[model samples]
Target: MHIVAVGLNYRKAPVDIREKFTFSDESLPVALQQLKRTKSILECVILSTCNRTEIYAVVDQQQVCGHYIRSFLANWFQIEIGEFADYLTIYEDNEAIRHLFSVTAGLDSMVIGETQILGQVRNAFLLAQKHNATGTLFNMLFKQAITMAKKAHSETSIGENPVSVSYAAVELGKKIYGNFKNKNVMIIGAGKMSELTLKHLHANGVGKIVVANRTLQKAKELAGQFAGTFCSMGQLEEMLVEQDIDIVISSTGADGYVLTLEQMEPVMKKRKSKPLFMIDIAVPRDLDPRLMDMPNVYLYDIDDLEGIVESNLEQRKREAMKVDKLIEHELEMFHQWYRLLGVGPVIGALQEKANRIHQETMSNMLQKLPDLTEREIKVIRKLSKSMLTQMLHDPIMRIKELSAGRRGVEELDLIRELFALEDMLKEQARLPKDFLLESKPSESDDDRISPVNPVLA
Candidate 1:
């Protein structure tokens, strides 16, 4: 058996092409059923997110399975094969395993080191499991991937800092005050930037948001979204003093300063030295730069937030190296387990072949020794079984050890040829009963394990 991953991701496909292949939550089960119904695909999982849509499957033939998967995708999504074929990527075996590990570790995310992809990966596996689309191989692989992802997050600082400007502002707020649950937030504008910043703050449990804008209607509209209070820009000072707002996010479209040093110095004094955090996301700067020098007041402008974001991104990149090494370690461990799977069918076939020969010889001996007692016959049978096991022990152990390395399939084939167990091995090598019925590859196709390359036209 071989593992294969065929799909297009953010790196290879544009949003339009990626969206075309994306599977909806309601359609995922049906899609999985359709893929597994194909002759080549044995087991499968579909991972669809805003950035990528991937299909990971265990297949009987890697060489032709890519064609089968591509055909399935084109037919299912009702797209022309020529239209999106160039965007597809195919990975088999080790490459497939590494791709999955990287995805679960968040290394494949649009934003590196983001933790959301880890949960997304887990959800995809669970969805596949729910539909009975996965078996022993995928079950173990996905579980190990998730465990490795958790280890990456806990052991390294990949998800420690924020890499986006909006999130950086929130991170800065977190540094000043550990939690936002009790703090009041004051927004100086009702633009998209302010709304986005407010959204992050709200997510972090900020309380009692006050929206102040030149247009009272827009302020009220934005404030209504968060169930917070609204006010006109004229009452900004009163709201600053009376509302006890701890964080001020200003993004007004005014050339002049909205909150000058002269205006905030008195408000700072009235608040009895309470610490204030301000984020100014305006081009000309809404909050006066001089306000940063004021006692108990911390201010960050657009450039400042961008600097923090850049620095955090660098830190995440550094942490990603640690995650990469962790993935390599986990991949080796998973490969060891996967290699052992090949040994089982081969060993089973060998045992079956030997038992047949032993039974044939014993039947002929029993005919010759008709006077032998039934108890003596039983003793002879037990001795024959014990000798067979002892004789095969060393060879079986060597086959298992060799199977864990690169020449596993070659060695197994040699063993089958040597024991004249070709037919027996073929029966044992058939896809498991639980798997969907599929056409087996011909003898000539057995050695054709190479994957189809994406048409980069």
Candidate 2:
């Protein structure tokens, strides 16, 4: 199988395009079923989120699969190939496998250690599994990928940091205040990050939420979703003073700081020095960085939250080395399985050899012993079949174990060379019932990272 991952992500596509590809919970099933209808695709899974829209497929002919899938995306999003290709990225074979592993491990996520993507991956795989759109290759690949992601989280300190700049701000709040269950949150700015962080704060159990944007209508629209208060920038300071916000997450698109230390200094004095967690995720930084040094004022600029994001990213990178080793081990195991995938052909040749010999012997004996009773002939046939099974049992068992991946591919390859399987197939005219039992066993695109590429059909 030629495993391929083709899609666009937050890194490659803007929010509008990304949102265009986002799979709503209501529509994933239909899209997944549609993906399977394309030719060359033996199995498929679609993972769509706000940040990415990726398809994982096992195909017979890669060029065919790639074309159909790309065209499908163009049609679905109503964009030309040239127009859309600018935002798309593709990975074939082992690069595809590595990408899947990295994604599940949180290395490729927008948030380095956020636990959400893992759930999304699981949900996508499960959706495919439900439709029987997944085969052995994908089932094994996805299952193992999930396990590796968990290992990355459990075995490292990568999950110790925030995943997004907005989330980093919330994390800074949690670090200082422990829980957000009873705290009020006023999400400043109407940008998408601000919207997403507002959702995160709600999900994290913030008691009350307030949306304050430059446009009161946008704020009102967003406030409707979270059931929060809405206000305009004209009323910014007044709203800030009136609401008693415990946390401020700002992503306002402004040329300069929206909240200065002088403005906030009096606000703090008006209220009795209540600790405030102010996170400015705006590019120009909505809050003054100098305000961080003030008492009862915990302010973080975009650079500071992003600094945490970078350090956390480095930590995730360090932890990913361990996941890499795990994938390495699994890759070796898969190679062995691939070698063993040839077991069906081996056993077929062997069984045919035995049966042919048995048939010839019986034919000649039956002509010679014309007076032989029917019972006697039947007994001879039964005896010959018993001998065949007993003679082949041990070797067949060993070859099968090798095929099932218990034996390494190199060792299995040695067995194939020893048995001269290519020559055997040429010599044998007919194969038995078990000839292709596993039907393309080593057909996994996710092979080990090695000096050699998988011997593709």
Candidate 3:
């Protein structure tokens, strides 16, 4: 069978397009079952997140797998093929494996090195497994992917740095105070940026939060979300001086600077020159630039935070190189297992045929020489089976080695031809019942590793 992945991510499609293809958690089991019933899909998993939606499948035909998956999406989501065809990207076999590994490791995420994608992949695999939509191949492949991601995170610093603007603000705070614990924060706006910054601060266990906005109701609404207190723009000066605010994040839509150096000078003096941190995230510059030059005043603008984000992004890129090497190693291991799967049925059929011939020969010799003692017949049967097993052992080992190497699918056919097992394979019922050619190959099946040689033991 062939492995295939077909999907559109944030890089390939906009939010609107990606959202249209998402699968709700409640619908995933039914969706997976339906996808598995498609002509080429034997096993399937759907990974649907806000940024991307993808389907990974094991299929009977590589050529038709993509078309069938697209059709499945079109029918299930009620979207036209033409509507999303341009956004779709399909990877087959090794490429499919590589893509999954990269995605699970967060290399393919819109935000590189983000850990959320790894959990999403794990959830997708688990959901598929719970629904019986995944078999041996996917079970192994996805487990490896999840394990690799965990390894990447633990072994590298890929996720250690902050890459978003709001996060950068927090990281800068860390540089000055190590952490925000027991520090009061005053957020100067009711905008989305202000809310996000407040969230990061609240999560860091800041002592107290005060939201200040020109509109008192808007400030109250934003503060209520985080269990923070609110103050009108007119009370900004009084709140700073009275509350001993340690951090000030300003992102107002006003045209002029909200806090000037002159305004903060008296406040800093009144607070006994205590350090004050401020972040100006507004487009028109809410916090005064000259305030940064004042003693005990730590101030940063959008440009400064963006620079930190860019630097952090570069650091993540460097770490991703290490993850790539890990991915390469996992891909090799997966291919090794896959190669053995291809040769398993052929080897099983060969052993089954050899046993049939050995049984017939032994029975005929025993019947022809009935005068021989029972002990003699038993000895002869044991010796005959041993000889056959000894002869098959070396060849079986060599075949396994070749299959696990760079040998292609055509080599399996050649091996079958040499053993004259072609006819036996065609007679499906006569083939060994243990050798399930269409289903997943068992790793514990002796024939997969040693063929008829195990009979000697």
Q: List the candidates' TM-scores in order.
A: 0.64, 0.62, 0.68
User: With candidate 1 superimposed using the best TM-score fit, by how many Å does residue 354's alpha carbon deviate from the native?
Assistant: 2.6
Ranking by lDDT: 3, 1, 2
C-alpha RMSD of each candidate structure in angstroms: 13.0, 11.0, 10.7
Clashing pairs in 3: none
Clashing pairs in 2: 336-409, 340-403
Where in model 1 is the C-alpha error above 4 Å?
164-199, 202-308, 427-457
Residues 1-457 of candidate 2 have per-residue lDDT tens digits of: 6899999986777654554565666777888888898788889999976567899999999777778889878877677888778888898977888888888877777667666688879989999999988987889889988887887778777677557656777777777678898898888887777877887787788888888887889999998888899998767667667888888888775656677877877788866788888876654446777888889887765444434456567877776677678767766655555554565556666665555666778789989999999899888777776776677677677666656654454555676577666566666436554554644645221121111112321
lDDT by residue for model 3 (1-457), tens: 8899999876777645765686766788889889888897888889986567899999999888888899999999899999999999899989999999999998886557878778889999998999899998999999999999999999999887755456777767777788888889999999776887888888788888999999999999999999889999888888998888999988776756788878878788888888888887655567877998999888887556534556678889999999999999999988887777766667667777877787778679878987989788778867777777788777777777677777746677788888998787777556576655666755323222235432222
For residues 1-457, could you state the per-residue lDDT of candidate 1 as single tens digits?
8999889986788654665676767888899888889987788999886567899999998789988998999899899999998999989999999999999988877556777678788999998898889999999999999999999989999988755445767777887789998899998989776787788888899988999999999999999999999999889888988999999988776657899999988898999998888987664567888998999999887555534556668888899999999999999888777767667767767766767667777789889999999899878877876777677777777778787777767877787788787798677668586442465655423222222111110
All candidates in order of TM-score, best leading: 3, 1, 2
Computed on alpha carbons, the lDDT of every model, listed in order, comes to: 0.81, 0.74, 0.81
Which candidate number has the best TM-score? 3
Clashing pairs in 1: none
